[model samples]
Target: MGMSYRRYLYGERVYGCSKCKTHLATIHSMISRAFNGQHGRAYLFESVVNIVEGEPCDRPMTTGNHTVRDIYCIKCNTTLGWKYDKAYEVSQRYKEGKFILERNLLVDVQ
Candidate 1:
């Protein structure tokens, strides 16, 4: 046999896309963000497909006015995460072109 497709675990096993079941990312994919009042700390990412970026916003948060973008599932248009454009203020500086996917946004499939 060959390598079989992998599945993610929640209450049950999942394949991908809560709406479309399209395999996007893997279990190891990590999305971390700060100062989100709703989620409190960091978001999670099972898979990411689409990214919609707009003009820069001037909100003072992580790194102060980090350019924000919208990440979505390419198959079903589910909003998954947001990408930061610049990393001038961050000490790590690796987050300049990274995203933060919400854990709640993902759905488990079989």
Candidate 2:
């Protein structure tokens, strides 16, 4: 059976992966609820996993020093999106507050 996202919205904290039965964390937007409406729930986020056996980046760093949070699927280990600290700073500058929205979390229910 598919995961019940609706249930997660209603205070169901522990989300066990249907396939692997691993507990998943519930991440929500730190800003307005508008993101919630767009995501059809109260939050849009994921977990991050270490990429093992991956080649090191050879590209030069041009974006400056910034911390990023990556969202991933706890069960399938799917990467959702990266939330940069700079992004939050920019949003705050526009009075948008602090919030991370993962575009991949939006379901195309059509």
Candidate 3:
């Protein structure tokens, strides 16, 4: 028999809009930071998430007037994750360490 090649799709398992999927990397990073004791320390690179063709936001998403170094998805307009200046604040106040790795995000997975 000829070589049977199996196509293996190696990428984010996006169940929602493409924009949300695109920010998987950033989300993962934020989760990692939180796990590592870096809380509320999100960085948003691009401007605030914009309303894309497929994705629409009920209300404008704001970074709480905080400038970060992370990028948001254009499709879903979800605040995937962020690296904020108030890392200490998050570490102290926020009950959760990371935002992306929160239980809510994994509701479908479970």
* The candidate that achieves the highest lDDT relative to the unseen native structure: 1
Candidate 2 residue spans exceeding 4 A from truth: 1-7, 11-65, 85-99, 108-110
Model 2 lDDT tens row, 1-110: 76533223323343333344333333332333344322344333343222111222222123333354444444455543334333224433332112233433433211
Candidate RMSDs in order: 7.1, 9.9, 12.3
**How do the residues 1-110 of candidate 1 rate in per-residue lDDT, one tens digit apiece?**
65444333343333355566655454455554343523444444434433334455544564455566666565456765566666557583566666665555555555
Report lDDT (Cα) of residue 86, candidate 1.
66
Number of clashing residue pairs, candidate 1: 2
lDDT of 3 by residue, 57-84 (tens): 2221232232233323444445444333
Error of 1 at 93 (Å): 2.0
Whole-model Cα lDDT per candidate? 0.52, 0.34, 0.29
Candidate 1, pairs of clashing residues = 14-109, 44-103
Superposition-based RMSD of candidate 2 using all C-alpha atoms, in angstroms: 9.9
TM-score of 2: 0.31
Prediction 1 global C-alpha lDDT: 0.52
Go through the candidates in order and give the clash count of each: 2, 1, 14
Worst 10 residues of 2 by lDDT: 51-60
Off by over 4 Å in 3: 1-23, 26-71, 85-103, 106-110
